[model samples]
Target: MQITLPRIGTVAAWRQQVRKLAAAGIDPQAVIWSVGAAAPDLFATAAPAPGVATPLMLSLEAVDGIEMALLHSDPERFSRAHALVLRLSKREVRWGDRSDPLMRRLLDQQKAVGREIHKMHGFVRFREVSPPGANRRAFAAWFEPDHPVLEAAAPFFARRFGDMDWLIATPTLTARCEAGEMRIEETEARQPPPKDAAEELWRVYFASIFNPARLMVKAMKSHMPQKYWKNLPEADLIPDLIRSAETRVRAMHDPSAPAPETLPGGRMRKKLR
Candidate 1:
């Protein structure tokens, strides 16, 4: 039977549908899962009658892994996850077994989602957007994610910035937090909020703390991919900073350079070293 799912199916939807198919003893191959509004084959079987659901149990780790993997942007993710779920339910398959190709793929995708979540948390910069009459401070940020991860990533921001009102907008969805309440709404691609004074301050702070002596472009890019640079305020400074790194480090080590001193007013002055 062919099962047609929404273009962007949620974890819950996948789980529910999988459960029904599994209960009916339907093999993954027997059911063709087409996502979005793709036309079904003319000879496709109609939706099968749902069987009495057998108690489906899986390790919490397996559940979490598959859930996050579903958020991946890969079009084949649904079929892969479904196959894995079927295997786990019917047999005593160890989800952590790397020898199994399906399990390995799931593991890799899980890691991808984890990395994306970490990057979103670290790189999302909020710019103040309060108007003149606003009693509470407001901020907003624009992010572009590789997966449908905003829902999973929202809780961290909610807890960390509990006292503030903010919105994190992305191409697929927007996560809005206000008055300690969190909400995710479907949204189209949006223009980034206007540049604010705070962004400049953050850029200056980032540059000041950057250590040219430790600069490693390859390692840096490995951790912070180039794809994310467009949304990061500090990224614009990276090229110039990298180009001049050798000169900056040389100045730091040059004995001919001035020694910095603290003045009475707490300002620092430089004198020949």
Candidate 2:
């Protein structure tokens, strides 16, 4: 009976199964394997010609009657089946394994991170923040993102501001530069932030806008998940701030807390070494 091998996505795992068949006494010399959506033309003379494939091919045959066959009962049971493929991804090597699960995962991960890194390199915002008349120059910026993406993002800042001092603090990590040297620090810990008129006022504004009459608790949680609530400056506003329309109106009317005035790019800048 002609065996029909199962396929996943576009990967034809026939080559691997064929090798296993060879070692298991299903002599490779006796069986012809060709990869495609359709079966290959069998010459029926024992030795079949190799078919064309996008990826290069490797052939193996049993020298004796003892051949190999796959334990089909468990193809994906080996977790390390993908280990070899992952190593290739890290080295930026692309392998043609239409049927290898690990190779597919490595490609997916590389694509996901490569895009995010490219965006961070282009879009990160930084602000200069050295107090006037200070001996040196300094800068700071704020950003909100879902993951620990700072270490991979530090190189962009170093390249952009090789001579200036600055810091980029996200909810999870902080990248800082001093005297033209840059380093990343993990900030999984939280400290009480300095009391700010903006945060308090934002809370008031938030509570006042919340309307019990129109509230949908399920929808609220869906739109604003628990994970993001703690890190947002606007989160504290949700609980008490949204209680009534009157409070919200008062907050809305309040003047936006004025930002501290600083000379645009203070003239006391150091010449890049």
The most accurate candidate by lDDT is 1
List TM-scores for all candidates, in order. Answer: 0.86, 0.37
Candidate 1: tens digits of C-alpha lDDT, residues 1-273:
877765444677778888888778666666776655677687667765554444577889889988998878877787888888867866757888889998898889889998999999988999999989987899999999998789889899999998999999998689899998988877665878998888777777777787879999999999889999998887887887777677666668985655444333222344543
Model 2 has a clash total of: 20
Worst 10 residues of 2 by lDDT: 62-71
- Tens-digit lDDT string for candidate 2 (66-90): 1111111133311222233223324
Q: Which ten residues in a row have the lowest lDDT in candidate 1?
A: 259-268
Q: In candidate 2, which residue ranges exceed 4 Å CA deviation?
A: 1-82, 85-98, 188-273
Q: What is the lDDT of residue 264 in candidate 2?
A: 24
lDDT score for residue 170 of model 1: 92
* Top TM-score model: 1
Total backbone collisions for each predicted model = 0, 20
